[model samples]
Target: MTKQNTFLNDLRNEAITGVAYKNLMLKKQILEYFANISDATITDLSKGLNASIPKINELVVALIEDGLVKDSGKTEVGIGRRPSLYGLKSNSIFFVGVEVKKSHVNIGLSDFKKNLIKSVKRIPFQLTNSQASLDDLCIIIDDFIKSLALAENIAGIGVNLTGRINYKTGYSYSFFHFNEEPLSVIIKDKIGIRTYIENDSRAMAYGEFCSGIVDKEKNILFVNLDYGIGLGIMINGELYYGKSGFAGEFGHIQIFNNEIICHCGKKGCLETEASGSALLEAFKIRLQQGASSIITKDRPDFNDIQLEDIIQAANNDDTLAIELIAEIGEKLGRGIAALINLFNPELVILGGSLSATGDYLFLPVKSAINKYSLSLVNNDTELKMSKLGENAGIIGACLLVRERLLELK
Candidate 1:
């Protein structure tokens, strides 16, 4: 090659590397500033990072170029000149969140701020336990992205499931036919973007944490009472995935020695007695006994009875339904008390479909915890309902993608 061409190529390479380094530094500063405070002025950020005014300006310009930060106009104080404020631009990018449940999958597209833009729900039957089924899921995901015109704009995909997950290696041991196949690799290979997998309950807990609630509590636990019970633990503001990433499998803990079997091939697990499926089973037995309950009146077709129907019956003063829920709540509380004694978390947020019953489930749960737990531990721990509701999984998934990308920087 000619001397001029070689020198020009070297200059171009140097420029690219310089831009990459500056971008990385700016991203780091933006994440650190946002983590420490909700908002910042360029002057404040400059002073905090010990960077010069011109350098700060350049960094902010680069951040804006990357769509990671934005200027929110000038803030006026009571007395002096107005100062410009900067904050993370939550809508600069988008993520896709997939929640894989035993019966169905919920796919949601969300912006960087974790706001759901669009969602699609598909039954498990549509996939039907085959290789082609996995392809179908990919098609559905692709369709959802195409619908939103986000095929090129998406940053990554997040998978939330009710099973053991290895975020580092991207393997899911608990759900699907290819138990050992890395879910992240499969999705990434098909979708052409990064993919992350996390336990559903833990994802919900992280969603709540990221939402800025429970800021005062560094140690918290989220109990999900769904098709089966699950636990999500956070300590010192970080999700605690124990060795093998199966730390919060609280549903499998044995609370009774009864002969009743659990899905995990165990007997008398906490979920066997306290989960929504268990409650539904109990409701069915009582209904068959000619129990006087409003649920029976509402859904004469026993096959159609749902968790909400029983909750509604209890709300309508159905003695059988109310008594049954209280019993399950007591059992759940006992399991919660065990958690309190073990971890001594500052707060326990009850989530999942059963939590929809509100105080109908919480009251008895509190009573059981108070009755069974040591006074010191009980006093420090507060039981509350999850603020995120069903959207928690999707939001948590988006947060996962954001967190991973930030870590890369």
Candidate 2:
């Protein structure tokens, strides 16, 4: 591959002479520094990379010529000549982030500077357990790239997939089980772009870490309360993928003794009682049992009453909706309290559509956490709703592409 298309290969290990290899390594280091801090001076680069000022300055000039960086501005100073600041060019390279939701697909484009340049959300795409679904997804992605005309400049495509995924190997144990080829490999081959597939929950967690209220936090747990419940485990400031790379299946924990079957074919899993799907089921059951809701006032069949409609009704003071959501929150909090006891994460950010209910879900969760968790352990865990909201997976996918490209995450 040519140096211009560094997306398909590691930028630091290109076939080059010794002098060029050294220069490439130095440039890679400089790019890392710029990624962490948007702008840096020559002295800052030299000190950070442990290189001389002249050498660092030389590479910075080359990077500018390559269109990877630009002069942001001069560092503000009152006493002496201000050093110029170099920053990653916002349009130099791009990453495409795709989130495969059960009901829709979310695509977002992020620049080298991590700004989401454009996005197309809520495209009607159903993720079923079939090869046809995978083909449809690839076709949509191809169309998206062609429409944007970013096939050549795009660095990578990150897909946030739900279910059992070996992120290290890009092999999915669930869904799109058509071939022996890893999902990432199949996608990369089809789309002609370097591709990565990550668990939706873990992707959301990493996204929250890089872009959320995380302020140098080292340990975190991102709880995805979507159609199904899932967990993203982070320890010591790194995403922890356990043996076989399928660690964060927090929903399959058998918490209750009911006969309800989970999506994983397990009985009485946490998701059976505490997830968005569970909430929907409970809402419908209550309506069938003579409970009333604002949505039911118009349509008694309750077939169209989705999770979002219930959340909206709760927001509008629908008594039945609020009660059902609070009950789910209480159950979810019980499960989370167990997680707190186990992981003791410093921060827990709630992500997914179900978390958008705000205080309706949060209050009950907090109450349950306080009631069930050890005082010291609960005190160590700070729970908050995701700032990125439903976009966490898409944004996280974009950021992960950059992180993997730079070998920084």
Candidate 3:
């Protein structure tokens, strides 16, 4: 008997012994499939998963009986009896997504079918404000969940924050400043629901991969150009968190040698030149140097000018705003080109607030990539704007709960 033969025999024995386990896994798979898409017929599901129709039908029947799935009428394809469509009973289960920004928090409720139950509620609470405490944070979440009036139905809460989080351990290295206790455990104890935390970029990437416009492509980069830039790398259809879950800090990568210090304590980081914050900062610098723009043309004071105001001006083709955005895009493109060379991703997605700039951003970014990157690396790569828009983070947070928690149970 050889080692390979013994290993093969053990695998054969496990396969024979894992019938019940395999069925449970199959049921979960079917449920997840329904969760990701609108609805699917038994034939479609079987074909999609390449599994036996009888076995899938049997599990779906069990799922229907278990009140997890329901038949959603039928769809006629050609000229026959319509195949029955099934979907998850959305209201039967719920999840909460809390997206914490520096200045505000957006809380949302998602059904089992991954539909936002109501308009996302934005609470004006600052994570950086010293007046707010962990207790206050818990209360806000608890109150938000109570207001939704579906506290009992919620399986778990997912919080996506703009900081470094060891998502595996739920520890926050930036916000909350906790060392001994994971924030998830604290939130769970306070909110009376299972809680999970993730880096906002990672959560958005996961959501994009699972249900957003990315379509689960094997190799892709999701660059979130919000107040600051964050990168989400998906290699081989899985979110790459890297060692210590700090992989997506592309914003902090130093792209220039300058005296300007980033918030991350680095000088001349990509975010220092290309992020929403950096864009606004540059606009302010230009304003002080007596440069004029439609952004501050009607403003009470240049100090009151905002990033959105500049974005609006750019959308309307204000020369200064458009030029500034183009400049930022060029710098961002250089950084992205470096990433392309390293990762050789098939797709690079521009997401978050700055992505909304449309052509004002894309044209310059494309030009910079063409100039900076090797033709071989970027020729096949496609650049796209996120279809999920600002909802990416919230949707990702909601889905993360299901990805990390519900499936475990």
Candidate 4:
């Protein structure tokens, strides 16, 4: 090759390497700053990241070009020059989230900043024989994207399922039908967008982690108590999927000594005694036996009784309702105590529909933990309610897309 050509190629290679290194360093800084505060000024970001002013400026310009950050206009000051404030862009790109539960299906569209722009829910979307329902979910997602007028700008789609997921091959053993023929590939093909899937509980924990709730503490546990129980563990500030992606299947762990059958066909499982379904069953048995409870009197259809109803009944000081919730809470505490002993997490966050009962559930859980757990382990762990609320799954789904895109680039 000619010397001139070789020199030009070397220069190009150096430029490419320089850009890659700068982008990598800037990404680390941007993530750290975003985690520390929701937003920051370029000067503040430079100071926090310990980058030179020119380097920070170059990084900010590159991020803006990539549509990940935006200038929100200059901050007004009483003195000299106005400093520009840059923040993570909210809507330059979009992501789709599909939450699959036994009772319902929820689809949401969110921006880069994990803000829910639009959402839809379909209840009792049968999981047993539900191909049509799945197809409908695809249609709803397509419609939502079209509504946003950014169909081409969509980053990817993410689905959250309530079972063990194989992140490598995108297979789920718990939801076997969707395995091998992984939901990610299927949805990607059907919707003509990049797709990803994760276990629902893990996704919720990711949402909490990305939201700056669980910080560098690394080891944390998140328990979700809704129709059934779900658990998510984060180690080293990342989701810890054990061998076969079944690390956090806390619901099926046996809590009762008796041989009561669980949904997973296991006997004496935690879900059999402590989940919302378990509480509802207990309420029904009490009602049928002529036990006086406001739930039975107010809502005759036991099937119609929701966790919210139970919480409301408890709030109203319904004697039997309070007793039933407390019982479930106590059982849940026993199960959580076992987890605490085994995992010894720094934080344990209670989430899902049942968690909305707040202290009605927490008080009993605390009592049971005190009864069962060792004092040192119990003392170190902070048990708190999820701040993300019902939106955790959706936010996590969006983050999944962003995370994958970053990895790919």
- Which predicted model would earn the best lDDT? 2
Q: Could you report the Cα RMSD, in angstroms, for every candidate shown?
A: 5.9, 3.1, 8.8, 7.2
Name the better of 1 and 3 by TM-score.
1
lDDT (tens digit, per residue) of candidate 3 on 295-317:
66588597888776888888887
- Cand. 2 Cα-lDDT: 0.86
**Runs of candidate 4 exceeding 4 Å displacement:** 1-88, 118-124, 176-180, 212-216, 303-308
lDDT of prediction 1: 0.78
Model 1 weakest lDDT span, ten residues long: 2-11
Better of 1 and 2 by TM-score: 2
Write candidate 4's Cα lDDT for 1-409 as tens digits.
Answer: 3123221122123245675755664664674466347566778888887887888887777667666677888886637887888877676667788777766777778776667888776534545435676676677666766777766667678888887787667765566354348767777778877778898999888888777366666788989888789998998787898887778889998778977898798899899989988888888788778888677666887777766677778888888878888899999999999988988889999988787778889999989988999888888888888887777887777777667754411
Q: Candidate 1: misplaced stretches above 4 Å?
A: 1-22, 31-47, 50-59, 71-86, 114-133, 177-181, 212-215, 292-301, 312-318
Better of 2 and 4 by TM-score: 2
What is the overall TM-score of model 1 with all chains considered together? 0.83
- Best model number under TM-score: 2
Scanning candidate 4 in windows of ten residues, the lowest lDDT window is: 2-11
Q: Write the per-residue lDDT of candidate 1 for residues 71-178, one digit (tens) a residue.
A: 888876635788888887766667888877655677888775557787776445243445776787777677677788646557778888777788888887765447
Give the candidate order by descending TM-score.
Answer: 2, 1, 3, 4
